[model samples]
Target: MTAFPLLLLALAILSEVTATVCLRMASAGGGRWWIGVVAGYLTAFTLLAAVLAQGMALGVAYGIWAAAGVALTAVISRLVFKEPLTWVMSLGLVLIVGGVLLIETGAAH
Candidate 1:
């Protein structure tokens, strides 16, 4: 997890989160948002592949990417869409962060 791969991973997570938000909007009758959904997902996967090509382990990279995406999407959705953000979901986010940290630590050893 050099800086470059880390940066790509971050970008991938952001792209995925953006795509998910776009999907939500599209489902809620914003048809034009679909283009954003498609483009965001394509960019996300491309950056993910680039991260893998940068020699990062799949499990570690994907674990971090997925966890960060979920966490960010949930928080952003709550803020942007006025969706629920209960204590249980917050706890889940904490757990996801902890899990990602464990995976990253394990990969370092």
Candidate 2:
């Protein structure tokens, strides 16, 4: 299939993960970070809408969005906040990625 939808979906996922990280940062100590939180989420949703308009299937787009967002957010948390990432949680993230891959490949066919 075309890659445009996947591009938009990737943007959506990036925006969402950025927003989530900013939200946590804001809650921690910096109220100014809330600006990033709001902007990131708004951008994310806008990108998501654009993806849908571009004919990306909702199931596939949203699945990839959520899976990638969760996976990236977890990694960011570990790096930025020094949060723990157990092996089990890492495996779960792997499964999420695998599921998203399945959805994408299925949509391609």
Global CA lDDT computed for model 2: 0.89
lDDT of 1 by residue, 1-109 (tens): 4799999999998998999999999999999999989999999999999999999999999999988888898889899999899999999999998998999899989
Q: Which residue pairs collide in model 1, if any?
A: none
Q: Assess each prediction's global lDDT (C-alpha) against the native.
A: 0.93, 0.89
Per-residue lDDT over 1-109 for candidate 2, one digit per residue giving the tens place of the 0 to 100 score: 5798778788888888988988898888989999999999999999999999988788888888888888898999899889999999999999999998998899888
Per-prediction TM-score:
0.96, 0.91
Task: Please name the candidate that would achieve the greatest TM-score relative to the true structure.
Answer: 1
Residue runs of model 2 more than 4 Å from their true location after superposition: none
